[model samples]
Target chain A: MQAIMTLKQVNYQAENKHILHDINWAIPVGAQVTLTGPSGSGKSTLLRIMAAMISKTSGELVFDGQPIESYDPVLYRRQVSYCFQQPTLFGETVADNVTFPYRIRKQPVDHDHILAALEYVGLGEQTLTQPIVDLSGGERQRVALIRNILFLPRILLLDEVTAGLDEQNREIIHRWLRHLNVDRGVTTIMITHDAQEIAAASTLAKVVAGRLEVQA
Target chain B: MNLAVNNTSLFFAAMLVLVALGISLWQKLGLDKDIIVGVVRAIVQLFTVGYLLKYIFRVDNVWLTLAMMGFIIFNAAWNAKKRGAGIANAFPIALLAIFISTGVTLGVLILSGAIRLIPSQIIPISGMIASNSMVAIGLAFRSLNSQFHDQRQGVLERLALGSDLLDASIAIVREAIRTGMAPTIDSAKTVGLVSLPGMMSGLIFAGVDPVHAIKYQIMVTFMLLSATSLGSIIACYLAYRSFYNAQKQLK
Candidate 1:
């Protein structure tokens, strides 16, 4: 399989400390790779670097056939989306959060599609106009997830998005991820600590002491 | 009739401070030390400025006038920079904002013949314009800093969705500008009714016609509004970029 992203000797440093040393990894096209590591092992930092949310201290990162820097940051981010561990909902209502992707793209918001996505995530049509301030943690996370997929990206970076979800919601998210990866062919690179999720992943990668180790 | 303001009369004006000090002591306000220090500083500073202005006016040199204006603007910018302590390049940004606003307003005044290009005229007007711009820019910086910090998550989320820097920060920028311009706008609205401003009263005390003093005051008000608006907008546009990194990510 051709690789969608290749990071060669990427390193991240902050405040005179090497957070990620000379490290390298490649993400395959249409692959769901579970990334596991002990706490503070630079998992999220690596994910952010892949998402272009942060600049690498040194080394080369290429996306598709071109250098990441060659692409406009806005357009690059649109094609490669990132989800935060703590979901952030902006503006006033759930509809605001759900339709942001369309807003930024200057496309007409499809309320029907938004309602459908909310329903798929176990949130009803009534949740569309609900105030974001009134949402629970699970609801906010689901909204953020649905927002990320409103317009599909070639790759999705998940930074422990399901860390605090209940079993049912977690299962829903897992099923959603599988559908996205299998049916839609969106490449997924997720940081996770769930044992079952780790056991079930088709491809597993670990970041130990800032180094990548692929498991067969 | 011109009211006498010789040294004797001015010396007697010290009665006002004594009255204030007596009241503070009577009320047990414990403000005696502060009042004494403030009175002494005010006297010294005003006398020094008075003598400097007298000398600059006598010479009537364009360079001397310009140097005086620059001094006022530099001091104003320095004070404003303190309000934006953590913002990158805050001093230069403040200086530029104050300079442009003051320069533009003074240029218009001189060109319109409302004020002459001399120390007596240009220096005082420049002081007023620079000081107002400085306050406006300071308020703008404070607003920008707080808004960016408080709205970090919102800005980051917008960036994640591929919104460009300007698009991500438009709302915050507008809010900061509005915050900076609010005082000027409020004073314009309540100009004559709320209080008699300094320039008009000073002209009146100098035996200028009331109608003429009112005209000068109106001109001052218009110039102030223009100065503050320009300063706030320039400062905000320059400062918003400080919140982001080279990767276009929120710092």
Candidate 2:
């Protein structure tokens, strides 16, 4: 498979301290890649670099044969989505959060599509009107995930999004991710510490002391 | 009306400071030193400005008038910049906002024939405009810094979802503008009912008719409203961009 994203000699430094050192990686198209690392191992930094949420101090980052900087940032981000580890749902209610993707794109809100996605995540139609403060941790994560996929992206970057969820919620999220990867061919790069998730990933990478090593 | 303010009357007026100093001593408020210093500073500063204004009014040269206005505006911008410490290029942003707000307000007053272009008129009105705009810009900068820091997650979420900088930060920007303009708006709403403004009271004390003083006070009110609104809007729109980098990523 051809690589969808490539990074060469990526280095990030802050206050003269190196955070990510000499990272070189190629993410193949439609691949489900899991990144595992100890805390403060720079996994989130690498993901953010790929998402273009932060600039690389020195590196060549290419997405789809073009330099990452060449694309308009807003346009680039639409195709490469990033989700936070702590789910941040804004606005007044669930509908407000879910409808944001469409609102930004200037597309009319698709109620049926929203309903279907909500149901798939085990949320009911009434969840749309539910206040965001009423949501449980799992529900918030699910809503956040559903928000990202409402307007499908070429790549989905998850930063320990399933952290602190109960087993049932984790299983539901994992199943949904698998469906998206296998059935819909959405390339996924997830940061996880879950042993089961790491074991199940076909392609795994580990970051130790700011260096990346691929583990088959 | 007794308009005589000779050295004797001034000396008697200065004695009023003893009342405040005595209260501080009785209450053990630790404000006695501050009260003394404040009285001394006020007397020295006011006398210096009084003599300087007399000289400027006597000279009455356009360049001298402009130079004094520039000094006032510069001082206001410098103070406002201190409130915007962490924001990039905060000083220049504040300077521009204060300058434009002061210039536009004064220009309208002159062009509308509400006031003459003499140092006696231009200098005092310019001081009011610049100082008010300075305060508004400072408040706007403070609001922007705090909101951007506290709401970092919300901004990042929007950015990650592909919203542009303007869309992502519109809520914060509006809130900041409101924060800056709130004091000016509140004062406008309760102008005469709450207290007599300095300009109006001074004019009335100097034997101008109460009706005429009221008209000048109305003009001041209008001028301030215009100046503060322009200053707050300009400062917020410019400062919000500082939170983002050239690549549109939050710094």
Candidate 3:
């Protein structure tokens, strides 16, 4: 079966230092994979490369069998969403931030669908109209996640999404992530340092010193 | 009216020097030598322009007048570019905006016969409009570039959703224009109440009737408002375009 996403012998260098060396990894359609690594082990960098946020020095990246470079980067990014470690929400209101992608695309936003997405992420209806600055850290993360899911990307690349959340919020996010993967059949590739998150994921891949090691 | 440096002039000069000295001493609290150099440069440049204007007014040559206007536009562009580093192509955009805005406003004044097409009228009117537009364009360019940097990811996400570059940056561009023209808007709103305008004051000092001077001041202020608005909008649009690639995608 063709993988939903594939990285073959990918090597990346920055500032004359090798950041990612010979990374060969694949996420089959609908698979939930977690990447765990020590700080500066290139986990986030690997995700960035996969998301096409940065260019690789060598090798190939493929999305759904076609080379990633061939796919329009913007289109690929839309289909393959990348959630940063920190929740970055733009605009004054939560609704504004949520509807940003739709607004940019000139698509009419479905308020019902947006509310449903927020509800799924455990955010209340009130959150849609709240000022962005008023939202707590966990709320902001949920909002960011909601934005990603609202676009309904085929692949999700999350980088330490739950690092700053409390246990309760983390559990809430974990449940939603699992639901998205198992129920909706959305492919998820998450990078986290949390042992519990790694253990809970369907598959865990460890990276150390710029090399990938899959754990059965 | 005789042009003489009186006690008021000396007092004002002394006050300015004292302010400069205070600021220079305050540099100990993080003010650098560059600030002093900038003030010194401003004094030299203004004095030089004062001397040059004296001779230019006597000659009243159209070519010399136009040359000075071009110089103003060029300097405005240079300053805009200097302030808008990391956003290439800002200089030309600002230059075009200032040129078109000032030219249109000044042209209107000339066509209306409100101001004669002489060095005296064209020079001051053009200088005021061009300088105001310069500030507006500079602010617009700075705001647009900074907003682009801040919203890079948000912009990418929008593009991914199939939004065009212009669509993604429209909000930022609007914001830039608003910020750029804010000073002009404030000045127009508070004119005569907050302070006597330079144009009216200068005319009154030269023995022009207060009513006539008020008319000129009104025309100048309105022209500046229009020029600043136009320049800011044009510069912001061009600056927005500069952030994108040939394929109409954000770079």
Candidate 4:
């Protein structure tokens, strides 16, 4: 099995306080990994570091056998997409959020692709032109999910993506993630505090006091 | 030829008595002592500037003129930098913004022979250009800081979706520059109807021909618009980076 991302002795600190100390993890290609931990256990920080949103104080972060530092940060983020725990939507309309992938790549926004992605997320085709301000939390989360995956990134780092979703929406997102991994072979690193999500994950990594304990 | 400023004491005393009315009103309105302090500082500063200008004009060297222009820009940039204390390296950003605007505008005037690069023309004109640029940069900085703060999630989300730093901040940068330049644009629109600007009023009070003063004032407005637009754009571009880290995440 080939590893897609390898972290060795990762450490992060701010203002004389340690956030992550000596973290070592390997994310294999096409694997779905879930990170579970209590609040303030540095799970989100670890996820952000994985996404290259923030750099580690000291460590080697390698992606696809190349040091993450070797890749252009913008292109790296394009391949390794990071979704926040909160439903972070940009611009006024769902089209605005969904078309973001095309806008970044300097490619024309395909209306059909946007509509299809929205529909896949249980949103109607009419929802594409709808203003994000009018969206409920669950709808916003689904919109964000579709937005991140529209370009089909190699790795997806999701932080509490289903926290605010209803049971139906949660199941919708779960099926999407499963499809993304099984069908599309996209690598995933997710942070979830829910017991059911932890129990259901094929590979579980728990962080406690900035230490990782993997149980598969 | 220097214009005579006669009866300086009487003029100042009358001004003081007039401002006392304002102080009384401010006190009634529960305004703080900062107002009084500001007024006192203004008096001291103007008098000091008056003496310095007298000497500088008497010396009448190009180097002195350049020094005065530098001093004006530095002071203006310092004040502008304070408006966005949260931005890292704000003073340098403001200095660069003010320099670009003031330098390019004055360079055009000098190159076109619209104005002489001398103490009389360069000092006063560059002062206006620099100060206006200062205000524009301050507005740009504040707008950028607040926008990045309020729209943290939006900016970061865009980055995650593969938007480059420039692409992610395009809308915000546009808004910030517009916000910075709006006051100048609006003021120019309402010039004669709303209020007489300070430089025009000063020229008229000094007994210059009204038509001549009006021409100078028109020139001032055009120069200001040019400087402020450039300054705000530059400031926004430079300051936007402070909100993001090395990996393009919202800091």
Candidate 5:
């Protein structure tokens, strides 16, 4: 499979503090990679740079053979999605959160597709009509996950998506992520520290002291 | 004929009421120093302006008239810049808002012969416009800051989901402007009922024709509303732009 995303010599520095140094990686299409690291190690920062939520201090970042800066940021984000650690749902209803991709794109709301996406994440169609404020943490995370995939990004960047989830919900999320890779060929790059989570990945990478160490 | 000397004495008598207010504040709220200093500062500032305006009106040099107008606008903007302390180009933003609102309204009035460009006509009207615009812009900054703080998560989410800054903040910009202009709109709605307006009362006190005073008061109201609306919109736009950094991050 061709590389769907590539970062070369990426150095992220803030206030002379080196967060990530001389990082180089290429994520292949349909590959599931888990990035493991200690707390405050630059794992999430790398993911953010991949998601274009932040710019690298110095380096070349290419998405699908084009420079990241060449694409419209909004359009780039649509193609490569990022789900924050703590899911932030906007507006009142779950439907609002589910329908945001359409709203932002100025496209007609695909109600059937939204429901299907939620169902794939183990949420029933009825969840769409409910208020998001009342959802449990796991449910909110699931909703956030469904929201990110509704538009079908080429690559998914998840930041410790299951850190606080119970085993039941964690299994559900893991299953859906695998399904995305297997069925839709969605490239997944997740920042996680869970042993079982890291073990399931086809490729593993560890970040320590501002350097990326890829392990198979 | 117009009780000019008597009114001057009455103005001093008004100071006694202010003193009473200060004393009551001291006795009841322990705000003695604040009230005394505020009242004294107001007296000194107003008297100084009154003397300065008297001299400017008599001088009749066009450049000096324009220069005084600039000074008044600069003072108004300087006060408003503090309201948006974090906003980049805060002072320039305030200056632009004051200039546009006051300039556009005065331009129309001069064109229509409703007012001349003389110091006497320009100074008082410009003061009214600049002061009201300053307050409106300040409120715009305050509202912009608070709304962004409250909607931070939502904003970032939108940004991540492929929405540009303008798209994300359109609703917020409108909200800030509306909130900024709300006081002026509400005041306009309740004028003459809840209170006699300042210009009208002052004109009537000066023995101008009641009808003429009412006309001037109406003009002032229109000018104030227009100034506030325009000022708030400008300030809100500038304040909103300040939220994003060079990397388009909401810092």
Candidate 6:
């Protein structure tokens, strides 16, 4: 099996504070990897580095055997979708937010596919026309997830996506994620502090103070 | 009509002073003393220019008019810089835009015989063109800065997707251009119905025929629109380059 993403001895410092230091990690293709850590354990920083939101100070990152720098950052990001911890919806309508990536890419947007993705996330058809500001937290998370899926990225980076959701919504998300990984072979790297989610993951890695230690 | 000091002027001046004092006393409201000082300074400056203009009209020396126009441009540039303080090298760019826009507009107007090359025509027309350009440039800078800030993350996202920096910023640049031109557009739309413009009113007061004053007014309006559009477009394009580094990444 080939590794989908590799971080070799990565070191990152932001605002004079060491965020990720001497980090070596690998995610094999089609793996369901969950990163579990305490608050301020550099999980978000590592994810951001993978997404190319911030640059790493030292070492190399390679995605699918190509040096990350060799590929355009925007193209890389498009191929790897990062669902933020706090969902950031751009447009006023759900349909607008979902189709944003397609619009940016200048591709033909399919409203039918968008509606299907929304339905997959348990959102009603009418939700597409509803204003984003009127949506609840759970609805917004679903919208973000649908957006990521619609973009059809090779890798999905989840950052505490269900942190603020109720148990019902949490179960719905977990089930959808499990189905995505097990059935579709979609590569998923999720960060979570939830014990239930940690127990359910195929592989669990703990991060402490910028260092990763795979749990026994 | 009698040339006596009108009660309206005294009342307006008194009201302005009262507002300044009130704002000064209410420091907790975030109104700074510099704002009050600026208002007072403007009052003094405009009054001084008014008295000097009377002597200038009497003497009718072209050099004196040109010299005073230079002073007005310098002051306009300074005010523009103050308004757009955060932009790097904004003062020089703003001054350059103002100079180019005003010079082109005035030159075209004079050459076409729309405005006679005299103090009465040149002074007011040049001042109007220069000040309007200054406002347009200031708005362009402000809109550019705010648009960049608001869309920085989205722009970075686009860059990571193999899009060029120019491609990523195109939407924001378009928005800024639209916002920067809004005032000029509004003025053009409402020129006659909403307000009587200063140049036409001044001409009427100087005993010119109404038809003649209307022609000059129409010419001035079109000139202002052209000057503002050119200044804003040039300034926005120039300022946008400063936001990115050589590595094609946002700074």
- The most accurate candidate by TM-score is 2
Model 1 TM-score (2 dp): 0.87
**lDDT, model 4, position A99:** 80
Q: In model 1, what is the error at residue A133, expressed in angstroms? A: 1.2
Arranged by TM-score with the best first, the candidates are: 2, 4, 5, 1, 3, 6
Which residue pairs in candidate 4 collide?
none
Which of the two, 1 or 2, has more DockQ? 2
Q: Pick the candidate with the highest DockQ.
A: 2
Cα misplacement distance, residue B232 of candidate 2 (Å): 0.6
Which residue runs of candidate 2 sit more than 4 Å off their true CA positions? Answer: A106-108, B16-38
A34-139: candidate 2 lDDT, tens digit per residue: 9999999999999998899999999899998999989999989999999999878988899999999988888999999999999998999999999999999999
DockQ of each candidate's interface versus the true one? 0.59, 0.79, 0.24, 0.66, 0.55, 0.20
**What is the DockQ score, from 0 to 1, of model 5?**
0.55
**Is model 5 an incorrect, acceptable, medium or high docking prediction?**
medium
Q: Taking the tens digit of each residue's C-alpha lDDT, what string does model 1 give over A130-195?
A: 999999888899999897888888999999999988998788888888888999999998999999
Better of 1 and 6 by DockQ: 1
Candidate-wise lDDT, in order: 0.90, 0.93, 0.83, 0.87, 0.87, 0.80
RMSD of each: 3.4, 2.4, 4.0, 2.9, 3.3, 5.2
Candidate 3 lDDT by residue in tens digits, B78-193? 88777677777878888899999999998899998988988877888888888899899888878887899888877765554445667778889999999999998898899899
- lDDT tens digits by residue: candidate 3, A1-216: 568988899999999999899999877899889899899999988987777667788998888889977876667777888888776677799998889778756689988988888888788788888999998888888887887778778999898989989988998899999889889888998998887876776788988999999874
Cα lDDT of model 5 by residue, B154-193, tens digit: 7777777777788778778999899878988999898888
Off by over 4 Å in 4: B1-40, B111-113, B208-212
TM-score of chain A of each: 0.97, 0.98, 0.97, 0.97, 0.97, 0.95
Which of the two, 3 or 6, has more lDDT? 3
Off by over 4 Å in 6: A179-185, B1-81, B85-126, B144-175, B186-195, B237-251
